[model samples]
Target: MPLMLPFAVEELEVFGKCTSGMWVYARNSTGSRSGDKIVKRDIDLCDEHGRVCVRLKGLSFREAEADRNPNPGATFPETLESFMLEPVWKPQAVHTEGESLGYARHLVILCGMTGFSSRDTAKRPGGMQFVQLELSQPDIAERFHACADQVFEMIRDLLTEKPQERVLLQVVVPSQGDQQLFAGLTGLLQSAELEHARLIGQTIILDTDIKFEELVAILEENKISREKRIRYQKGQRFGLSWNELDAKEGDVPVPWKDEGVYLISGGTGGLGFIFAHDILRQTKRSTLVLVGRSALSPDKRTRIQELSDAGAKVVYKQVDVAMEDATHALIGEILRDYGKLDGILHSAGVIKDNYLVNKTTEEMQEVLAPKVRGLVNLDEATKELPLDFFILFSSLASTAGSAGQADYAMANAFMDAYATYRNSLIKTLYRHGHTLSIHWPYWKEGGMKVDAETEKMTLQKYGITAMQASTGISALYRGLASGKSEVLVMEGELTRIRQHLLSEAMEQVIPPTAVSEIKESSSTLVETELDTGNLTDKVLIALKLEVSKLLKIQSGAIDVDLEFNQYGFDSIT
Candidate 1:
C-alpha cells in the first residue's frame, strides 16, 4: 500500500454502474487502438452478478473540491448537521495512465470506507475489496466481502486533502442500532489512545470537543471572521431542519433519487404545455412526452421548437386513447424510444351537454368514449412501462351531480371507479408510494369548454372561466409528475361542489328543501337530447340552448331558426 497522505475528503458521492442491470458508457478522449478521439467504454463495476455497478469516471481531486464549494448559492445536504464540506474528486479527462492516474483521490476515500466495512456485515455490500482485508466474513453466505470496519477505514483514509487540515465527520444516527455502534466505536477509539476521535453532538463528534470555539479558530485561521462562520453554520442548520417542513415521516433521511421520467396525456394541449414548460425549467435532463388526439397546430409547432431549442427533449404524438389500436401503437412507440416509463398523467376526455335519458346513444358514446373507454385504453397501453404511477384525471362531478350533464357526470364517475380498481391492482403487483386518485374541479378555461359557446356558458354561470381558451394539460401533467394523487379544486363553486360531494358521501344528508328546490328549478336546466335521424329545428335549438344554460350563459344568436352544419347541426330552426 502507498504511504498515507492526510488530504481533506469529506464531500463524497457513491455512484456505481450496475453491469447486469444498468451501466454508464464513458467517452474516451483519446483511443489507443483505433486512433479515435472519442471512444465508448462500458463502465460496469461488477460482472456475472445480477447487476453491474460502476463509479463516476474521470474525477479530479482539485475539481472535486471546487464542486463541493460551487458558489455562494450552493445547496447542501439537509441531513448533514455540522461537518466539513469538500469534494473528494472533480470532473476531468481520463489520462493514459488509466487507474493509476484517475482514481488516486477515489482510492483514498475508498480506504476510509473499507475500515468501517471490515467490522460490520450489514453496512457492507458484498464483493468489495480493500488493501488490508483479505479475509471475508464466514457467518455471511451471500457473496460476503469486507465488514463495516473496513468500509470506515477507506472512508477515513480519503477524508484528508492536507496534513494540516482537520476533517469533521457528520454522522446521522437515525436508529438505536446506529447510535449504539457509533458510541462503541468512539469508546474503542478513546481506549486506543488515538489523538483524534472526540464526541460532539448526539453522535460521535470527532476533531472537535467545543464546536463553537473550534469553528472560531477555523474561521480565523482560514481568514474568515467568527461571526460570519457562525451565521453560515446557523443558516445551514436552519436549512437542514427546513427539510422537516412536512415532518410526518421520521427524521431519518430517505435516499435521493438520481433520475426519473414523467409520461403525460394531452401533453400538447394548453394544460400540458404549461406543465411541460415548467418541468423543462425545473428538472434537469428530464424527458416529457405529450399524448393527445389532435395534431400540433402551427403555433404549437413553434412552441415545440422553442422547447427543443432549450434542450427539453419534448416528444408529442397524436393518438386518441379511445382507439384501441392507437393506444397499443403509442405503448409500442414509448417502449422503443425510452427503455422504461416512470410516471403517467391521464388527462384526455371529451365533454358535452347530454343527459343520460335525453342523450341519443351515439351522442352518449361520443362524450363517454374518452372518459370511460379512453381511460381503460390508457391503462392497457401503459401496462408494459415499469410504471411508477398510473394516475387518472377524474372530475368532481364524479362525486357531485351536475344538472344537464348526466352523460359527463356518469363518464367521470366511471373514471373514479376505474382509478380505484387500477390502483388496487398496482398495489398488489408493485406497492410503492401512495397510489392516489385525483379529481380536479371544473376549470373555467382550457378544455373545460371546447368551443367559444362553451366559454360563454362558463362565463355566464361562474362569471369567470378557470380554463385557458386552451386546456390546462400542463397542470394535470404536473400533479401526476409529482407522484401524488390530489384533487386540485379551484377556490369557487368548484370548491363548494367538492365539499358538498364529501358531505353527501359521508352523511347522505341531502337537504329536503334543496332537493325540492332542485326539482322546481327551470326545465331549461335539464338537458334535452336530439334524435340524430329526425331532422327538426327543435333539436338544434335544444342542444345549443340547454348546453348554454348549463354553462350559465345565453345561447348563441343565429339569424335563421336552424341551418344544419355538416356534423348534422341545423342552422335554420
Candidate 2:
C-alpha cells in the first residue's frame, strides 16, 4: 500500500501587477524541509512574459500506518485552515515583480504564525527564526522607501496576527561587498522604525570564503541572540587582553620597508597630519601619498615641503575617496608612479552629530561615505596589490554607543566588520597583507570638534581624559607593529568609563584591578580635605595631594619643584 498525504492552500491574494522578464524564487528550507517521510507541493502563477506572478509553497508529513480513509466532508479551504494552524509547517507567498519593474525585484509575503523555533537551535538557543528575502537591483529613493514600508507593514501584520512568539524578519540584499548596500539597508531600517518585530538588514557578499552555515551562525550569535539593536559582524572577539606586549615599545616590530610607498586618506586632517609626520619619521626614505578632498593650502604645502626636506617623498591628491572610480584612479596613479603599493592609513571620515530621531538620511550617508564606502573602494581596488598593512581608523563610539553620534558609530562599526571580513579573505588567499581597525578615543589635541561644555561633561561623566596627540600616535605605531587585527586605544581611569558602559561584552573585558583602583581613588578623594592653614600652605598642600593622587601614591611622597619627568609627566600633561 502507498502512503497518502493531503494538503491545501488556505489564503490567496494578489499583491500587485507583475512586470516582464526572467524571475527567480528562492526558498530557505532550513525548518520546512526535514525528516524522511513527507509530502511536497509547489504552485506558481506565471504571466505572459514568463514571469512568476505568484507562488505558493507547502510541505507536510504523516505516519505511514495512519488511517488512510478520505473524509468526504473535508473541504479544501477547511483542510488548509487546519493545516495553516498546525505548528509543523507554514506557507509563505512571494510576488516577484520581474526584471522590468522599477520597484523591488522580489517581494516576499510572510503569512501564518510569526514565532517558530530556529533552524539550528542546538548551536544558538533562542535564536531568531527568519526567512531571507533577496533584492537584486537598486531601487530609486522613493521606490526603496515604498519597498521598505511594504516590508515593515507585512512584519507589523505578522506581529499583530501572532503575538505569542517573537518574529524575526531579515532583508538580505546582494551587495558583493559594496558598502553602499549596507548604507542603504541601514538608512531603510532607520527610516522605517519597525519597533514591533526583530528586523535585520544584511548584505550578502558573494565570491567569498564565508560559508552559508558560518554566515547563519554569525547572524544568530551577533544580532538575534544579543539584545543590541544594531550589529555588523558576528563572532568577533571584542576585548583583547591588555598585556605587556601592548605597552612595550621596541618589542613590536614594524612590517613596512623604508623604500615602500605609504598612502593616507584624509591626510590633510589634524590626526592625519600627525600620523603622516610619524610615518615619515618611522620610514624616512618612504614615499607618502596624502589624499584628501580639499586643495592643499599654502601652510599645508610648506608642511609637505618640510616632510620632503626630512628625506620623505610626499605627494598630495585632492580627490574624494568615496567615489569608487576616483579612488581606483588614484590607486592606479600611485602604483604607476611608485611601482608598488606598500601600506594604507585610512583616516578619512566626516561627522554629523545629531540625535537618532533628528538624523537625516543625507547626514548619515555624508558621515558614512568617506569612512565605510571609502574603505570598500580601497579594499576592492587593492585586492590584487601586495600591501603590507591596511589600517582603518575607527572610534570607541562604535563599541560604546554615543548619544548624539548614531551615524558615526554605525560607520565605525562597519569599519570594524570590514576589517575582520577582509582579513578572513586575505588569509584564505594566502596573501601577505595585514588589516587592522584601530578604535581610538578622543585626542586632547587634533581630534573631533567638541564644545567646552561637552568636553567637561566627557571628562566628568565618562572619566575619559583625552589622550595626547603624541601618546595616541605612539599607540598607533605600536598597534601596527604588533600586527593585531583590532586594537582599542583609550586613556583614562577605566573604572569611570566602565560604570557608564552598559554592554556586557565591554564589562567582561575590563580588568578587575582597574575597577578596584577607581573605587579606592574615589574614596581617597572624599576622605582627603583641603588644609585649613595660610593661603600659601593650603596651595602647596593641595598641589602635593593632587600630584600624589595622580601618581597613585600617598601625599607624603610628593616634593615641590622636583623634575616632573622623574614622575613620568610629559610637556603636554
Candidate 3:
C-alpha cells in the first residue's frame, strides 16, 4: 500500500497495450500559492502520434506539522443517529397472498423466505405473475458473500427452472448503513430479467431489530402489485414513493445560495452545461464552478460567456474526478478562493456497454470509476463543508435495468446507495448538507443522441416519452425542494413500467407494438394501398397521413396512439 494521505490509491485503467518510444509530458498548470497544503501535477505518456497511453493525476501534498485528528465525535458503529435518515418504504396494507392489483390476477410464489416459502399459495395465470424471493437479514449479516451467492442461485433457479411468472423480488437488509452493500445488491436485483418472466425489482429494508411478525406483516402487504419498496424501523413501516413536477410551476426554487459558489462535475459540456444554465436561470448571479475531464473548447467557451451574460460567474476546472487527490485539490482550491462553497451537482460518468460474457473486469471498473469512485471522491472532498445540496445524476437503468449495461447499471446502483449513505450522516458529516440521487430517464435534447426511430422504439417499449429539457430541469427543482433521499422523475404509465421494467413482460403478452404498427401503416400509405383488413386500420392510416402533413414530418414518423384515454379530446370534439 502507498503512504496514506488525505486521498490514496484509486484504480488505474489501461486502454491499449503500451509500446516503446512513448513520450511523457509533465507540467503544473497552476502557480504555487502560499498556505497551500497540496500541489497538483499533470503527466501524460503518449505515443509518437501524441496518443495518450497513460496519464497521471497530479497530486502532491506536504506532511502535516502535528498529529491530525479529523473526527472527535463517536464512531459510526457506536451510535444509530446517522442511520436515522436512511430511506424507508411503508406498506399500503397487508393483503391476502397472490392477490390481484387491477391489471390482472398474478400468480404469487415465495422463495428463500424462511417459514413462508412452504406456504401453499394458489396460482393465477393472467399473462403475468409475481414471485417474491427473500434474503434473510441474519444471513446477510453473518456471511454476506455466501448470501450473495444465495441471491444468485435463488433468482437463477426461479427464472430458469420454475414456471414463468412476473417477479417482484423482495430483499431484506439490516438497519445499518451498509450502503455499498445495499446498492450492490440492488444491482443484482435490477438484472434479474429473463425472456419469459416480467420482473418488477423490489427491495425491503427491515431492521434486524424488528420482530419476525413485523416482517410477516410487511411481506403480506407487498403482495399487491402497487406495493414495491418497504422498510420497517422499530416496528413502524415506510414506503418508497415517487414524485413529478409540473413544468409550468417554477416558484418552487432550485436549491442555490444567493450569488453562492457551486460546483458541477462533468459541467464543461453536455447535460452538465445545460444543468448550469438551468441553475443560473433559477438562481441568478451565483458563482458556478464547472469541472470536467476536458478543457473548454471554443463552443464551450462561448456557452460559458452566455452563462455569464445571464448574470452568473462561471469557473471551469479541468480535473479527473475519478482521481481522489486530484478531485480533493480542486475542491480545496474552490473553497479557498471562493471563501464558501454552496452546492454540488455531480453529473459525471461514463458508459461501457458490452454483453456480460464479453466484458472484462477492467472495463467494468473503467465504467464505474466516474460514477462510483467519482461520487465518493466528491463526498470525501466536501464531507465537512457547510454545503446545502449534493445532487447525483443517476439513471433509470439502475432501477429499471438495461441490457449490455452491467457495469453502467451497477455503477449507478452505487449512486443510489451513496445518496442513502450521505443522507444518513446529515447530522454528523454536514452542517446543512443534504444529498439527492435523481434516477433520471433519458432527456430529449441533453441526453444521448439516439436516432428518431431508435428513440421512438425505446419510448414505445417503455410506455414512456423522452422527457423534454424543460421537464427535466423542472424535476431538478422539485427534487431539491422535495427533501427526499432518492426520487425517480418520470412521465408515462407507471404500471406499464412496473409490469416488466418494459417487457424484459412484453415478450409474453404485448401484442403488436406501436413502433411496428407505425411502420406497417407507413408502408401501406407509400404503396397507396389500404390494409384491407379492418375499418380501424384504414381509419388509423387516414389520421396518420393528415397528422403527418400538419406536423411537416414523414408519415412514418407518426406513432400509433397507444395512450388513448377515455378523457382524451380536442376542440373538434
TM-score of each: 0.39, 0.52, 0.55
Give the residue spans of candidate 3 off by over 4 A: 1-88, 92-172, 178-181, 194-204, 209-250, 282-285, 295-302, 305-312, 428-431, 457-463, 491-573
> Each prediction's Cα lDDT score?
0.41, 0.55, 0.60
Worst 10 residues of 3 by lDDT: 75-84
- Choose the strongest candidate by TM-score: 3
Candidate 1 displacement at residue 27 in angstroms: 80
- Which lDDT tens digits does candidate 2 get at residues 391-410? 99887676545656656766
Per-residue CA lDDT of model 1 for 1-573, tens digit only, reads 111112222233444533423434444322322232222232334445434354434321111011233563532222211100111112222121221111111111111122233343332222112232343333211001122234233333432222233222222111121111122122212211122222111111122222333332322222211010111222122101101112122233211122446667877665566656666776667777788788889988898889879876777888888887888887777778876567776677676663222344456456667765676676766664566666666665544445455446546655554554455556566333333445564454443533434433333333323443123343443344444333343322333333333433322122223222333442433333333346566665555444443433224322122222211222232
RMSD of 1: 34.7
**Candidate order by decreasing lDDT:** 3, 2, 1
Model 1 regions more than 4 Å off: 1-259, 355-358, 430-435, 449-488, 492-573
Better structure of 1 and 2 per TM-score: 2
Model 3: per-residue lDDT, tens digit, 423-503? 878867553588888877766777655655444445454445666677677677777776777777665445444443323
Model 3: lDDT to the true structure: 0.60
> Which one is best on lDDT?
3
